[model samples]
Target: MAEDVQINWGKVKNIFESVTERMGQNPDRPAIGAPKAKVRVIKERLFEAKAEGHTFQIDEPVERGGNGLAPSPMAYFTAGAAACLTSHITQSAGFLETHYTSLEVEATVLWDNRRKFSIADLAQASLGIIYNIHMESDEPEDKLIALLKHAEDGCYASDVVRNETPLRAHLIVNGDEMYVHKNGAEIPDVPAGPTFGDNPTGMSKDEIAAKKRDGG
Candidate 1:
């Protein structure tokens, strides 16, 4: 049998209560955070991204003109939304002192790619996302439903998809400001940087092993 997952309800409840109390004292208090990611293209349809001290690679499938070395950007986006909802559900359950044997969340993203490839002008690229929650618990059905509702309301990723969020895009070419979508203006181009060389051939197995052995 698999070991049961454990959570400290007392700690969870205390955290929620403390945050609520703080917010109640200052209703207009702003809690803003900006997470940043630096991405660089490695080759066609392949990129490396560094965020929060972690680095990861993103690539498209072989059919999409990539080497199929990693998951695509859409995969990460879908996973982020699903994971956010699952996190909220788990945290809310702990806060409410609800018990559960297992919890699983499955997500499906319906998308149209006609506009992406400039083949046709579509109404929207993302049709919708469906999330299915499979949870095993002895709790009352009403309680479970309430928990789901709370999680849906609190999930930021779900809100982003459901609401119209303004996006400001800017393009910088070779360290020169090229365009700003917010103002719908193109800036005068400056001297361009040095042209890029051929794509790098990564280390071989022997070199990688030697580096590992040398603690590099």
Candidate 2:
């Protein structure tokens, strides 16, 4: 069993208040952060990733051509969003001087695998996401509701989901730039990868068992 963890709300409140005061004085100051991740393929459906001096592995399930040794990418994606919102809510509660015994956040993402497997293109890969927050506290309902609203508005992950973000892809092959893709626009005279024709064949059960035995 895990031990109970305690938080110093006084310190949290002081830090938040000091940051707010400084930001208020320099309203136009720009604060920016660029978080980067480097991923390398370990096998057919297994990968290793490094970010912020931390390393982790990502693997698909047996049906997705992997040994199922680690959490899938989608799991990380959903958890990241949930964790971001939870952090914001905790900080907001501290700044508001609200007391809570426990807080929990759950996130779910609806997905359609047909498009991913080339079975159909009628639906998107990710349909939508739902978030539920539960808190045990003696604070008034209205005050808690207000704090939730403020935290939701300030959550970076929520903002990313609610807004449209542009993505640019640069393809490199054999140490040369092949093409740059932006907004699904075609690049003239650029070679394209093979089209999806059939579903991928995953690892066999015997292979998965052997991988597990080897502590993969």
Candidate 3:
């Protein structure tokens, strides 16, 4: 059992059962959620955003014409994906009783101006942002692989990244509606990337016990 994952296994099963029962009773009960961010531009390439009562600053690098006081917009996007994967892994490990110590997920996003900002290329490039995810864990090989598969399949962030979602743009000029762009397309979803191979660390509990006994 990993100490860092402090989920109460005793209640997890009950909670899951309750959720299942509720869904069965009310099939149309919607799971509602929305994320709101209020961004105020401070200067060219710099802005401050408030979301969920938390405030954060975002800025481009000096070369991009900002003070570089904080992470770029892309950094936040990548970080969100990493955070989602980490949370799912922790929850799955606890729920499934998968033995493990520590777990870490690193996400790298690849995108270029041509692919992201160019109107001509946007329609053609299905993969505006390609990401690679790497996982590190000390659990048994099979257990780790199972955990990874579960997280990959169920993580909302990864699913959003992998699938394409449309965006609607509303443009206003002098308080008058200037344009409304309904052009929307799905964004590519992220896929499983490289991972540490089977028993990469070879630190399973039984192996550790044997090593201690051998004392060689």
Model 1, 72-149: lDDT tens digits are 998988998999998888878877777577877888899888978989888679999999888888999889988898
lDDT of 1 at 105: 86
Rank by TM-score (best first) = 1, 2, 3
Weakest lDDT window of 10 consecutive positions for candidate 2: 193-202
| Clashes, model 1 | 0
Clashes of 3: 11
Q: What TM-score would you give candidate 2 relative to the actual structure? A: 0.76
Per-model TM against the reference: 0.78, 0.76, 0.68
**TM match of model 1 to true structure:** 0.78
Q: Which lDDT tens digits does candidate 3 get at residues 72-173?
A: 997898888888887777667666677445555667776545755665556444343433444445668888789778877877788876766576666878
TM-score of 3: 0.68
Off by over 4 Å in 3: 1-21, 116-139, 172-178, 185-216
Local accuracy by lDDT, each model: 0.76, 0.76, 0.66
Q: Candidate 2: which stretches are off by over 4 Å?
A: 1-5, 117-123, 184-216
By how many angstroms RMSD does model 1 differ from the true structure?
11.5
Best model per TM-score: 1
